[model samples]
Target: MEPREFFIEDRLERFRLKAFCNLGESGLGFFRLEEVLGMAGISVSDLLDLPMNDAPNQGSLELRSAIAKLYPGVSPEQVLVTTGTGEALYLAFHMMVKPKTKVALIWPAFQALYEIPKMLGAEIIPVPQEKAFLASTWKEIDANLYILNHPHNPTGKTFPDAEWENLLSWFREKKKLVLFDEHYRFLPGEGSLGKTGVDPNHSFFGTGSFTKCFGVTGLRVGWLVAEESFVQRARSFKDYLTHTVSPISEKIALGLLENKESFLPGIQTRVRNNIAKFTSLWRKLPHTKDFTVPQGGLVGWLMLEPGISSEAYADRLFEKTGVFVLPGSNFEEEGFLRIGFGETEERMAEGLKRWSECTDLI
Candidate 1:
């Protein structure tokens, strides 16, 4: 299948070779397999020595039990596990999206949501941040709303609680489908599973990864949550794709989530602390006013000084300062760049310092 080559991924590939601070990383950094081994109450050497193809396929009881602690209502039957949230969403799209269907893509968002649909020849309707639809955009109230209402790559710009209710009501009227990616759902105080498009007929599909909340990237463990039927169909697709997730990875994810109450509190502290440092450095810089602080998520979006294109700024920043941030053009927004505040406070501050110094913006 001819796929639209992901520009961001391509740019990231080249940036890796020359990058220093690597602040553009999306997830909360990574954890070593040995660390995971210890959490699982097992030995690293033994985990490494697992028989090749003999590992269990569906997942282990230890892991499932752990996951159960996270989502008390969500049983193993309800979870469609995969190599990563990427695979989970891939399978969900393949299962739910008809060939040539049109998908509503939220702007300045992850590329995979639209990229995968495009590969299937599905029409991508980008929900332009400039003019987001009213009632028709979501589900409930705006009579002037338009098209099938589904949302992917959430921008954290939803209407308020009452407004959201009206929208949901509007969507229910339209029988819309919302593929919500709560990847950045860093809600205040142990953000709970959101209730955006909770209607079953809404065909709401949610995808998340352990890489974010748990700070475990290499685990390759994430999931797609939907009603039971969707789970079954997606699982069928997953069975044929990568077959199944690693039993070992699932076990580790389970352990972290098993004590999610304990685990997430620490993550919250880290996020708050890092963002504080980033804010301090950002405010100190003369040109920092070009960007706004985000409400949730690890990323901060910034615009360069009026005279500079992000492409040139990013190139010089990396080459001279050994710091890196993905240029906005990669995300299809020129003159803009994305930063992750999930790094060490020192590194986040240092990267900003280097950017200001290298750009000669005292």
Candidate 2:
């Protein structure tokens, strides 16, 4: 069956290649192969000797084991490593959603979270960020599944642990499945929400990747954690899709995971610095109406003046300046812009300066 156009990705496909300052990109700047190898304590000789075959259908045992260690009490048997979080989300949606299923989707999320279910004929109920954090709101809706992004995309809002616990309990009591995208959950001091163990009852499925947190988007390493039976079912379904991740990617991801301590500090420092620079610059700009300082992740949700449409603003900015920031329309909303600060400090500063110049023209 044919799926509808994926708006955000399609938009990116058109301009991403030529954009001088890609403020729409969601991940931190990439890590070079030499740097990654150095952090992992692996030499070029080790990579040269790695097997060229596809990894196990689920994932290489060592890779899966390393992923499992991120979550307390989780075993490799409960993990299914896929090409990236994109594939993991696809698998989860296919396994859990069906025609007429009622899904509560957290809004302003990555398009895939809601769009795939909509394609499957599931009845979707949009839950705004404000309502999602409150237990009172969940009481009003009857849903079979709840799809959410923690350290949410675009907004970067994260609920407190108590709220999450309450929400999870409510889902458990209602027998609703929870598919949490924790791709941007990693930050300084605080670890990912996915680090919480998957329950044996199969109530929660956490999907994440190395792309956002560790700046290894090229590796395309992502995984899902759930009950063993759930993982088995998802793994079986995976065979018909991409089947298995490339062995080379799996080996590299394994090294990254094994040496996370060596790499994370520097990555975290860069991200924190960029965020500070973006926030400070944005607050002083004339066009800046309001914005949320992202608690985690690379993007900041920015509201422009009431009369300004984010789409038009972004387009004009791209034409006048070479910088790009995603319009809220890309996320099926309007009136806001998603400003990403994932680039280096210098690049981010230059992009913001260009944006300021574009605003002057407006």
Candidate 3:
């Protein structure tokens, strides 16, 4: 099958080699093993005692139990741990999406959300962020699965509570599957973490990872929350992939979840401060317009001055300043850019400075 190119990951892979100031990532800053263990209060002895073996295919009970605690009414059996949220998305789309199946997807999303299903020969109906939660979008589109990225990626705009209530009611009436990519749901905002009690129905399929909220990307630990039967099916499908995460990673993930209360507040504060820092600088650029204030998530969006190609400008920025940012074209929305501020304040300041310098030169 000739699949569509995954532009975001492709550009990121190339950026890894020469990026001096990275502003393209969409998650929290990476944490060192020592820092994570320190925050989680895990000791060297605790890690040493872990066996160097594969964890349970569906994840350890201890880890799943910790994850379940985040979502009220969810039990360990309803969670299927995977390498990361990326894999969890793959498992669900693979299982549910098929030829001719229509998927209603939120636009300007992480490419994988739609790309995976498209690869499975599914038909995609894009729902623009401006009207994503509109009753018309839900009622008008007869889709097999609806995908929503809470506090959506790139733009970070969230729907209103009333819209959410309306959508839930629609789901109850339609009984169609809805995939909630809540990777950034834990972000601090007026309604952040308010989704404590998920809809107790077979219609909801949720995927998230520790990378964004916990800043433990190296662990590659994430999970899928669905009905017990669907989770079991996903676990079986995982055997064809990585099968299971390493026990060491699972142990560390468990520690992170168990002690999330200690670190999450700090993460929220850092993200808010970084967004402030970034906006203060970004607004000064002559070429930026239509700037969207991010409600939550690590990244935000601003349109490039019309007539200037976002991809061309981004390439030029990297060339002139050694700073990297994602072009909006990667998200299928041109004339904009996604700037990440989820780094140390010092690094973010320097990156923004370099980015600003490039704007003047361009």
Candidate 4:
């Protein structure tokens, strides 16, 4: 069987490192190691002393315990630390999906959410938020599993706690498994869609990472939280993959988690400031419509003029101004672009100014 290429990631791989202004990245601006360590009151000498061996396959006990604490009532045994959320997601699909299993997936999501399951031969039914919010979409699909992303990517829409409760109740009643990609769960003021704890009787799984809200992408630390039995099964499957995380990454991640209280406030402040700057610039742009202020996360979505496709606009923008923005087609939709406001104010301003210039050419 052939696998599909990941559209957004592939485009990012081409432009991310080289772009003069990157307004397509999905996470908060990354933190330097010194900044992370400084917040934790750790010195280079402390990091230097950690052994260079591979971390335990299930992750170091301290790291797993720290991750467990993020989800209320979860035990260390219920967590499986992976290389990143990508691995956690991969493991989840591999462990739970069978050929022809019916899957319902949130639409315009991170491609891997549905693409991987589709590759596993699961029959996928798209659940668009507009229809799902209206509660009319669920009646049409008979699915065995449901996948979701919280504080969703591309659109950055979040559901209220009561809505999440009702959605989860519906899944539980149907005896369907639910997978929540909670990568942006801690994005300052975002409401979370994932449950606070592992329910002993429910087949719910949560995937998250230090890369997004924690601004520690280089550490590549992420995890899966589920029932102990499911975690154990995932861990066994992980042995066939990367086997274990890097000991160095585990050590740094532990430091960040331990000092989260000190670092998060500052990161959140920068994110909010950048967002405000982006909003100011967005108002000055021309021929843009259907734009919504992102409720949470770092990205904002906007539709361009009627005749222009997002891919064409993004290409022209990059060609003329060296500013990179993700085409909405990357998320399986067209005529829109995803603009990231996770950079410094100066960078965001320059990118937006460039974006204005490019749109003028359009």
Candidate 5:
């Protein structure tokens, strides 16, 4: 069957505060906005009173500069803001992938990569994972258009620079467009969409979001980086789609960007602590499930014992534990379950205990 993004809604709701790590959701995690606000001290009175009729210039300008600072060498012109990474992706696919266009997507990726293009009627060639895990090597897809995941979902595998370079060259040689998802770009030293000043004619586009990295899911903000021409086309589509982002949210996000250095380090510490806990727990357990310890992102996948289908196991676990999690079936694979430790420390500890009770000790 032509594959699609794994459906995870049922699993999470069914499970009792599931240990689901499939999607990049940081459960019950909140930005320390209060602390940040105190520092900004930019009171309601501080808002540069301007018309919200169009995208608020008050927030967007500085926000762009902030992004430029984080991702050095990338100009603000390359960064096109949208309501969320989802919107950025929707617009990119809508504008770029036509009915006859050939598309390649990484397996175990977010549901949208392949599903969106297919929905747009593009010819899809999915690079499904080899049996053991969700994210596989580049060899899986013979053709070139690469929909990639650095710190990929479900598996939490961060492709190394060497691999990224190889893939970049391959795409360039084959003259294929790349749609890279840097939703988890907060990972230190994560790969970029292209080499410095890489030509957009060969390298197509990228979508990055603050939601996954900054715990700002409510902000629903993301951006697209490509050649200026590509940005122009996407902007045209976006103008028709949502027009622009919320003026107020853009302001808050702008403030956060202004002080990311102080903020992100703390968030990273929280993520690292939770991951450390999960790593320690997994080491003791004998589920025989193995996966990469993510370098930066917030999710991972576990392969179940042979002959025990991930679907059946995940279903049974949810039935008994009320701890919901995404199964490998959701990623169109078998013998695996996605486990997220991106939740709060309490939830992480409690979820681990529940998981041991349900899986290993039982």
Candidate 6:
């Protein structure tokens, strides 16, 4: 069967190298090998002695145990390590979604949330992130599975605490399944940290990676948390894919988790500062309309004048300024653009400045 077109990835692939200032990338700036190793307290020699064999399919005991610490009442057996959050999500959707399966998915999210289920023949019902946690919205739409991207992608809006609790209560009462994509969960926003107290051992599934929040993109390590039965099935399904993570990556991931306390706070601080720089510039740009302030993720939406086409505007901006920002049309929201602030302070400033200078052309 043919796959759905992934607009965001396709656009980036075509224009990434042409742009000198990138405001489209979602992950944080790169970390040097030495800096990363130092943060993990691991030396090059430490990794050399590791055997080049496959790690346990379910992930190493130490790594799984460390991941479990993030969620209250979760056990190592409930976690299945995968290639990345994408793969974890794929496995979850593959197992749970089938022909005509009704899924309530938050809109303008990472495309995989919608595409993968559609590929599996699931009927997707788009729910706006703002209304996702509201009781009124849920009343009109009844679906077997609900997908929520907390500190949501593209927009970064988060569910308020009471609303999250109410939604969880509703899920429990209705016996519905919910899957949370928490890729940005570790990043702190104005008033939210995106942490949830849900127990994944029940009817919930959660997935995340070190890629976004921790700047561990190269490692490609992520995980799925669910009931033990689901974990077992995922692990079995994984055997058809990469089967097991590389011995080296798993060991390094273990090191990062062990020393996260020493580095994560600093990353959070840097991102907040970057966000400030982005907003400061955004406010001064002409022809732009007020947009949503990101509550947590690396990206935020920027609206342009009404009747303007976001994709056309983004194209002109990129051609004139060599600065690339994703159009909201990529996420099925046509009137806005998604700009990422996860670059280093220097790069972010330069990119924003470029956009500011080219306002007349765009």
How do all models score by TM-score? 0.82, 0.94, 0.95, 0.93, 0.81, 0.95
**lDDT tens readout by residue for model 2, 177-280:** 77877787566325533334245455777898877777778888899888988899999999998999988788788888888777687777777788888778
Window of ten residues with lowest summed lDDT in model 4: 191-200
Candidate 2 least-lDDT 10 residues = 188-197
* RMSD of each predicted structure: 4.1, 2.0, 1.8, 2.2, 4.5, 1.8
lDDT of each: 0.61, 0.79, 0.81, 0.78, 0.63, 0.83
- Model 3 has an lDDT value of 0.81
For model 3 the TM-score comes to: 0.95
Which one is best on lDDT?
6
Clashes of each: 8, 0, 0, 0, 12, 0
C-alpha lDDT (0 to 100) for residue 174 of candidate 2: 77
lDDT string for model 4 (176-205, tens) is: 678878787667353322344235357777
**lDDT by residue for model 3 over 1-362, one digit each (tens)?**
75588899899899844777777888777788899998788999998887887788999999999888778788999999999898999999989999999999778788998888888999999888778757667788888888888778888787777777787778877787888888887784653363522443656879987676667777888889999888899999999999989998888888877787788888888888888887777776658877777887778888888787889888888888888889999998999999886777887788777776664534
* Model 4, residue 205: C-alpha shift (Å): 0.9
Residue lDDT tens for model 6, 64-128: 99989888899999999999998899899999999899998778778999889888898999988
TM-score of 5: 0.81
- Structure candidate 6, residue pairs in collision: none
- What is candidate 5's local distance difference test score? 0.63
Clashes (candidate 3): 0
